[model samples]
Target: MESGKRKIRHEFLALRNRMSVDLVAVCSAGIFAGIKKLSAYEKAKTVMFYLSCGSEVVTDFMINSAFGSGKTVIVPAIKNSGDEKMYAAKISRLEDAYLFVYGIRQPEINSGNIVEKNNIDLVFVPGLAFDIKGYRTGYGKGYYDRWLKGVPFEKTVGLAYDFQLTNQLPIEKYDLPVGIIVTEKRVVQIKGDRGADRWETL
Candidate 1:
C-alpha cells in the first residue's frame, strides 16, 4: 500500500507541476478564496498547521484573518532524520514561515515557537488526492498520521484544489482520515468520529 501510494503521489505531483502558469494562478486564487470563506465561520479558536503543496499554498491569508479575529494558528515543522514526523509550530508573522525548495512551507528549526498537538483546535491537512469518503493520500511519510496519533482536535480539515480531489484513494491501515475536506469547489463531510473514517481505495 505504501509503495502504490507513493507512485500515485508522484504521478499527481508531476501533473500539478506541468500545469500552465495561468491555470496554476486560477487554482490558487480559487483555493485561497475557499480558505478565506472558512475563516469567516468564527467557530475555530485554535488551528493546527496547514499542510500544503506548492500549488496548494495558503499564505498568512487564513492565519492572519484567524489571528486578527482571535484564533491561535500553528504550522507544522517536520522533524526526524527522514522528515517522517512533524511537530506543530505557532506562527504569528509572515516572516515566521519559510519556503522550502522541495515544495513545503515550514518554520525555521530554531524558531522557538513550537507547540504540542493537543493545543490545536483544528488542523488543515494536505493531500495528493482525497475522496468524498475522506481518505487522503499524502507524500507517504506518514507524518500527519504519526503526529495526530492520540491527540485530539475540534476539526481536521483537508485543504486542496477541486482537481486534487477524487472519488477515492488508496488507504493503508496507518493512514488517517479527516473529518472534513475543503476544496475550491466544495466541502465534504465524512462519516465517523474525528480521524476514524479510514477507507481503502486504489
Candidate 2:
C-alpha cells in the first residue's frame, strides 16, 4: 500500500512540476475564487494556510487577502530538533530568515505565535494528490495529517489543480480526509458525516 502511494506521489510530482507558470497562476486564481465563495471561508475567524512552493498552486493571494479580510492568518512553521513536528504560527506578515523546508519558507516558530488547535476555523492543505473521497497524499511526513487529527474534519480543505484529483488512494488508519477540496474547475465538499458529497462547478 505504501509503495502504491509512493508511485502515485511520484507521478503527481512530475505532472505538477511540468505545469507552466502561467497555467499555475490561472488555476490558482480559479481555486482561490472558489474558496472565497465558500460560506465557511467568510465565517472563519481564523484560517491556516500553507505557503506555496515550486509548481504548487499559489496561496499568497489567499493569505494576503485573509490579512485584510479581518481573519487571523496562520502558517505552519517548524523548530529544528530531533523531533520533526510543525507548529501553527500566526503571522502578521510574511518575512524572511525564519526557516526553509523543502524550498518553502516558514515563519519563526515560538510560543507567542503558536495558535491553539481549536482556534483555527479553516485550514488550507497542501497535497501531491487527492481522491474524490477527500483522501490526500502529502509528502509523507504526516505533519498535516497529525494536525488534522485534532481539528474538526469539517474545518480542513485541500487546494489542488484539476489533474491532481484521482479515483482512489490507499487509505491508512492514521490518515484523515479533508472536508473540502477546491480545484481549478470546482469546489467539492465531502459531508462531515461522511454521507453525500456536494460538488459545485465554477
TM-score of each: 0.79, 0.93
Native-to-model Cα distance after best TM-score fit, residue 11 in candidate 1, in Å:
2.2
lDDT (Cα) of model 2 = 0.85
For candidate 2, the 10 contiguous residues with the lowest summed lDDT are 193-202
Best by TM-score: 2
- Name the TM-score of candidate 2: 0.93
Candidate 1 regions off by >4 Å? Answer: 36-41, 51-53, 79-83, 99-103, 109-112, 152-154, 193-202
82-166 in candidate 1: lDDT tens per residue? Answer: 6666778887765666676356777776557878777677778877787766778877767788887775422677776677777
Would you give me the overall lDDT of model 1? 0.68
> What would the per-residue lDDT of candidate 2 be over residues 14-67, giving only the tens digit for each residue?
999999999999999999999999999999999999988889999888888998
Candidate 2: regions farther than 4 A off: 96-99, 195-202
Query: In candidate 2, which residue pairs get closer than 3 Å at backbone N, Cα or C atoms, i.e. clash?
Result: none
